[model samples]
Target: MFEQFFPNGMLHYLAGGLLIGAGVSFIFLMTGLVSGTSTFFSSAWSYFSTLPFFRQKSFLESRQWRLAFALGLALGGFAFLLTLGNGQAASTGVQWWRLLAGGALAGFGARMAGGCTSGHGICGLSSLQLPSLAAVITFLTTAIITAHAVQLAGVLP
Candidate 1:
């Protein structure tokens, strides 16, 4: 049954999920902070922007560890490329403009919702937050609708 949906195997997905859950749990346990990537961008902007919003105490106080977290995410991907990825670059076959637009929309949505999927879906949901539950439902519904729409449009590359 699993093979029918995941032709490439499901072990990697399971392993990645486990690692993410464990990493988030460890960060929370040690610092009482929810490790969410969406806020990392704002925290990073604190380094260059002197705007009051960017200079918030929360952003400044958490920027250092967030930088390390971002670095770890980058290094992890690089390590994967060097190892399991066979060092070959992969392509999604989508146009760059489309990707950019999609990313911008996602970022905007994340900000409006007060967090990204990782923030709400993983950390918030684990803590039994009501907002996270609603956000997750919305996120999943939007994703499903968008995916179906895209497929129906036959614009796949």
Candidate 2:
């Protein structure tokens, strides 16, 4: 049954999930801070932008560790490519403009929602937050509809 759904096997997915859970748990235990990439992005802007929103004390104070977290995320992917992948980056075959547009849309949605999937789905849900439950429901619903619509349009990539 597992093979029927994940022909490549589930070890990697399981390992990744365990690692993520451990990392977030460690961060929370150590600092009492929720580890979420969306806030990291906003915190990072504090370094480069003079705008009041970016200059908030919360962003200013957290930007350093958030920068390190962001770097680790990038380096972790590179390390995975080097050690586990084909040692070459694979392209998704999507146009650059499409990728950019999709990223923009996702960022806008994340901001509007006050958090991203990782924030709400992982940390917030784990903490039994009601708002996160609602947000995750909406996220999953929209994702399912969009995915089916895309497949119906024969754009599967």
Indicate which candidate wins on lDDT: 1
Worst 10 residues of 2 by lDDT: 90-99
- Worst 10-residue lDDT window for candidate 1 reads 89-98
| TM match of model 2 to true structure | 0.88
Candidate 1 residue lDDT tens string, 2-86? 6899988999999999998998988888988888888888888999998999899999999999899889888988988899899
User: After superposing candidate 1, which stretches have Cα over 4 Å from the reference?
Assistant: none
How well does candidate 1 match the true structure in TM-score terms? 0.89
lDDT of 2 by residue, 23-120 (tens): 89988889898877788877888878999998999888988988887888889889889988869885687667657987888887986787888889
Query: Candidate 1 at residue 37, lDDT?
Result: 85
User: How displaced is residue 46 in candidate 1, in Å?
Assistant: 1.7
